[model samples]
Target chain A: MIDAHAMLGDETYLRLDADELLRRMDAAGVDLAVARPMGAGMVVDHRAGNDLVLKAGPRIRGLATVNPWWGPKALDELARCRDLGAVGLFLDPARQGFFPTEPVATPVLARAAEYGWPVMMKTGAYVYADILALAEVARDFPGTTFVAGFGGFADQWFELPMAMRNAPNLMLDASMMWGAGIQQIVDRHGAGRVLFGSAEPRNRYAVVLKAIERRGLDESSRRAVLHDNAARVFKLEGGRP
Target chain B: MRIIDFHAHLDERWLHKPIPDASHMVAAMDRLGVAQTCVYTMMGFYAETPRNNDLLLERSQRHPDRLIPFVTVDPKEGPAAVDELERCLERPEFRGIKFHPWLQAFAPSMLEETMVAILKVAARTDTPVLFHDGTPPYSTTFQIADLARWVPEAKVFLGHAGLADYVDPAARLLRDVPNLYGCYCGSRPGDLVHLIETAGADKITFGSDFDPGSWELLAERLDNTIEAGLSPEDLEAVLWRNAERTLRPSSR
Candidate 1:
């Protein structure tokens, strides 16, 4: 199994290093997980956090996060992280205090697109980061693959499946969403673009794993969601990282 | 172990899909080993108050042993809203009041006069009020805290416990305000643990927010609560004891 999203770093809120993450992954039967930096790395210094994530072993791959407010410097940081073996781009508009569709973030997004990387945008909270805004950003960047993290959970869940219906380039990582929502998206939209994301340390692996497990999907579809799609999106193919 | 879901939804149609009858809810409850659920209607919360409240009360009566009814009144309706709460509480089947300010489109601070009037009625009848919080502009934690502080006599529950964000403020309010209680619904597992550790488990209640026919979601939420690894005593309190106390008039 592959978890599309999980954090690594020791900070104020979330505390998880690569070894601890690998131990939890072993316990949960997860083969590979895409790692992002938490806390200060998420909000402040992108290079410092990206450096930490790039240091993970083969079982873990890194996703780079850059604060768009950093402007041209942010693009430089994204390029630097890409050189450091960061697989994809992760942006938290809510935490970073910028909207996904805002002009300030578009240059960085364009840079990621040029790198042929998928961008994971945190959704479900903060008006700037909800699925609707994600849909808008996806429309602007037709070439780039945009993954909606948490997939409009808690509040925007009611409109998520329909929003995904309209945005074809948009994919989703099921982190904090409910089972029925995931089931509906897969049953209607197909599971080709859907990936299983545990959002671990912030959430429990078992609980999120249970959501996909109980979605009543057949084995192939389940594998597509849990491992195949994420591997394809993060480009974690050809043996180890 | 007994589980009493403090938050769940009963609606004619959820996201334009028809929800099955109360039997569907009971069946899900049976599958998840949940004993009872405090049922609220989304119809009343989104649109049409009185009729939906009546339907919620009636449907819950079908399986009174498993489902408890909580009615919603849009405080945007002003005096008529207060009248509806009074009208619903006249029937013993209705145990609490639910408000979805984000959906109903009214801020508690903005609707202070109307909200206090409704809360006064809840205070008199000793009924708990559950608000759909954690969203900004209308349903943030600070707004709920202010409302809770305004009507100290009335018991309030922060439904969703700050959801994806705002859990810190939710935990703070839960700790500081005497009547403010937290519901472990819609938040991540780590956030739930943080709330319990910071605010204490005595006042927190477990909720699924499972719309009718969502058996998988019901089961998933229960799994999250268990995986949170609360002590047996704390788990018991969160699972049922807190809800049982909130359901009874004198306990709060």
Candidate 2:
């Protein structure tokens, strides 16, 4: 299984040992992690951490965070991220406290299209509704794939499954899947559509993996959500350690 | 490793009122292989006074091997707070105290005298005290740290201490405070790997803050933490070891 979303090294590190963070990912059986930049402050830090993860090598798939404020500079980093070994981009709908589909986001979307990279957004607990505007953006720019990183918080499956019901190019990551919305996601959408991801600090990945294992899904379906889908989307070739 | 879920809330809304019974909570623990949980009740937030410590005591009677109960009290009522502390100590079922100083509407700093006095007894009793700090009504980590300094003997656990700001502040306070440990329930994981690597896994505990995040949110937090990476031993500490040392012994 593949972790569709994750951070590079230790996020929120202050006097923290970066290697330890990598060690944690290794221990969790994550073949590759899509690490992102800190919310807003880490525009450059995102690049640096991406560089750090790249230096650490392939197991770390870097995801760059751009300051919507950075304008074109943010777009420049998109290629920088790809060069730095980052596989995609991580965006918080509320990161700069703006909508992802806002006109201001156009440049960033263009950059993703330029790199043909997947842009990730955090959506939890019916977050799908809030991301519909983002869906419009995804639809407009078919070249740029928008991954609803958290699948809009996996609430009642009412909004989460429905949001993704039609968007095949749009993938929803269940990285932060908890008891809150785990069952409904699997029940309504099946494990095939939801990629495996443990928000790392939210809960133990083993817990989520175990939940999926014990749940009604089969091994092949599990492998698709856990590994195949992420590998296919990110084009990661067996992300060997 | 004995589990200490330092940040979980067992509200009346959980399963039922007065005492919400989540037999499933124990079931979840059993499934995830958690040994014990240091739990508090939300009913304490609504009523005039704190909820009885026996809320956990009742659970321990059923699953002594897996559950540890903590006292959730209103520290705002001055001396009466001491009375509640006495009640908690009277029963061996409780080992620590859980307070939502934010929701409880009490200044832990202003209550230093009361805290020092109560923590004095807690020191003697060896009962650790866990307080809600981050979300804030009035209590802050700086303030909670101040209180911890005054009461050197009482082990102070900060429930969501640096989480409200959720950056280096929470990580720093968690490491700096000697008596204080943090409960990671509602806080974001963006910085959590840093907390575990820097703070020493023993200081942080896992909590789901379930009712607010969703009953199964802890499952995700566990997923994220594990994915963030740590050695088996360190991960075990965050999940159960450190908490076991602080909470389980006193309750017994």
**TM-score to native of every candidate shown:** 0.95, 0.66
lDDT of 1 by residue, B1-252 (tens): 999999999877865779998899999998889999999997677777899999998888899778889988988888999998889888888888899898888988888899999889888888899998888889898888889999899999999887777888888789999999989897877887889888999979999889777888788889889998889999999999999988745221
Global lDDT of model 2 = 0.63
**Best by DockQ, which number?**
1
Clashing pairs in 1: none
Considering only chain A, what is the TM-score of each predicted structure?
Answer: 0.95, 0.82
Candidate 1 docks with a DockQ of: 0.72
Full-model lDDT for every candidate: 0.86, 0.63
Across A6-40, the per-residue lDDT of candidate 1 in tens digits comes to: 99875545588888889998888888889898889
Supply candidate 2's per-residue lDDT for B7: 64
Backbone clash pairs in model 1 (N, Cα, C under 3 Å; residues 3+ apart or in different chains), count? 0
Candidate 1 chain B lowest-lDDT run of ten: B243-252
Residue A195 of candidate 2: its Cα lDDT?
A: 72
On a 0 to 100 scale, what is the lDDT of residue B31 in model 1?
A: 84
